[model samples]
Target: MILSIALKEWKLLIKEKGVFIWLLVMPALFIVLFGTVLGNLGGGTQTLTYIDNDRTAASESLMTALGEQGGFKLEAKQAGELDDQVDRIREGKLGFLLVVPQGFAEKMTAGGDSLAAVELYSDGASDSAAGIRSALQNVATDYREQRLDAALKQAGVGDEAREQALQSPLQIEEKPQNATEGNAVTQVVPGYTVMFVFFVMISMIRRFIGDKTNGMTARLRTTRMKPLHYLLGMWLAYLGVALVQCAVLLGFGHFAYDVALGDLAAIAVLVLMLALCGTGLGLALSMVVRSENQGMAFVQLITMGGAALGGLWFPLEYMPKSMQTISHFLPQYWGQLAFQDIMTRGDHLSGILPSLAVLAAFALAGVLVALLRFRGFMKSAQG
Candidate 1:
């Protein structure tokens, strides 16, 4: 019975080219788009106007670092246009403007510190400016350190002595604990995969709702079948589709984008677990919403909400401690973390036990909710 129902759902879903394209093809399209834009255009790099009032070697070096560091692209601007530049920034014509004060080289050469002021002129509500701020600060700090080191060397102090006496005491060495650890894009890939998968999968639920509303469910029920049996089959078929979609995405990341996807066996396990959980989630959501339109709205909202809370778009490191604490309640967070551990960290299967357990719990919870909802709807139909 379950097999028959599953086959029916599979055929029904296959007939809907729109839903199939949205589920399988659209995500791949977006992944290609993500790779094209983010890979070529540079990820997280900001464009700032470079108003070099002082064209000294130090300022030049700073500009070079900003450009070479691959964080911000430095654009030259006239000094008189500083305010207008700010207005342009506010008007969305630019990101921000940087100004190097006059006499910067003389002060540095004379052993006096000079401030290189950056005019971060953006209209109110630019919290997205956090990344830009961090990048610029890093650029500025590098300039100061390099200039100070050069000055100390010129003053006959050995590099070792200058470092011991003046340089920061902290020496932080960043080494990737695993293959994908040091690579920013690779580390975030899993989060993106999980986020978009959730979004696309949930969005596909409109097909199920459409079927239910068009008397398809009633027509099938006339064959003397149980609701749970039919639901189980549909769940299985969708789960299979979800698994294939995830596998294709992972493979593309590995072969095309050079994203280190960790151990194959571990990745398979993660995808399977997530597919199950997503299937149940999609099914339960489809049952709960009243109409196909309402289902689309609800799924869109939930998908975005889950991804936002789950560190999909950004790392949780920047979030408040309270928000971080709350994020654990989201299943997407755990799923991404699990993928990260497996793919980025190259952890053994045993290392991801906790996350695997959590994912299993999510799958169980979602399935229970879906089954309960199915039961309720079935009883109403029988009555």
Candidate 2:
């Protein structure tokens, strides 16, 4: 009986063109658009335009050193262009410019504790300005070390003394502790996948409401189909739909973006639990709303509001602390967190048990609610 009803609902959903648009097409577009934009944001070389007024080996060496250490492609602009570049910066057209003053080499050559100024003009709003600033400071520190070496030699100190004098007391090392490296694809693919899963509620709500208004719910009682059986059948049908939707979205991410999916067993289990949670909520909502419009409004609220608060669009840490705490109560947050932990950290099924348990609890709660309200929902069949 369950299989027969589920098959009927599935065929009806397949006939609706909007189901494909909502479930597959929309999410694919989001993944492509966001993935491309963020993937290329920091990919290419940034040009650092400069005017070397010193015109000597010291100035040339400074430019070479800056280019090598700063991760930038250096471009030489004539001194005549400095004023135009400054104006462009003020007008938000240019990002960075370096000016080695005429007396810079003279000061370095004289070398008795005199400071040489290297002017860096940057647009106040530019994000790359800090990187350039820090690089220039490092170059200045190198020159200062050169001066120290010379002074030590003049004072009859040995090379050993100079080496000891210049050695830094602190050294910092960066260690990556995750199995897979994180990138824009990791963020966007799983993010939108978890977010759009909730949207399956809209279709479920519409179908359940349509059945009630058309007298399909009450009429089913004339057959062997019990009310609870009908509810379970509808939930089972949409659970399959949500599972297929997740599989397609995740598969698209893997193929199109090369997103690494870890722990296949964990992923499969998570998808099943996610489908149950989504369809279970839909069943509960289907039995509660008096009208399709009212149901859609609630769905939009849950979908959009949960997307924002649940770290579907961005990292939860980006939100305020209070909001982050609140997101713990949302199923979307748990789903997204589990996806990230698996895809990025290589968490297995055992590691994701807490998330799985939470989703199960939500599914159980929703199913209980649906069972309690099914009779009232049947009573309001307008058709």
- Report the C-alpha lDDT of model 2 over 1-383, residue by residue, as the tens digit: 88888999999988999999998999999999988887887676678889999999999999999898846889899999999999988898889889999999888887556778889899878676777788888888998888779888999999998899889999989899889998888988988888788889999999999988888876887778877777878888999999999999999999988899998889999999988998888888988888899999989998889889988887887899999999999999989888988999999999999999998999999889998998888766645
Candidate 1 weakest ten by summed lDDT: 179-188
lDDT of each: 0.72, 0.88
Clashing pairs in 2: none
* Candidate 2 lDDT for residue 191: 84
- TM agreement with the true structure for every prediction: 0.73, 0.91
**Which residue pairs does candidate 1 place in steric collision?**
none
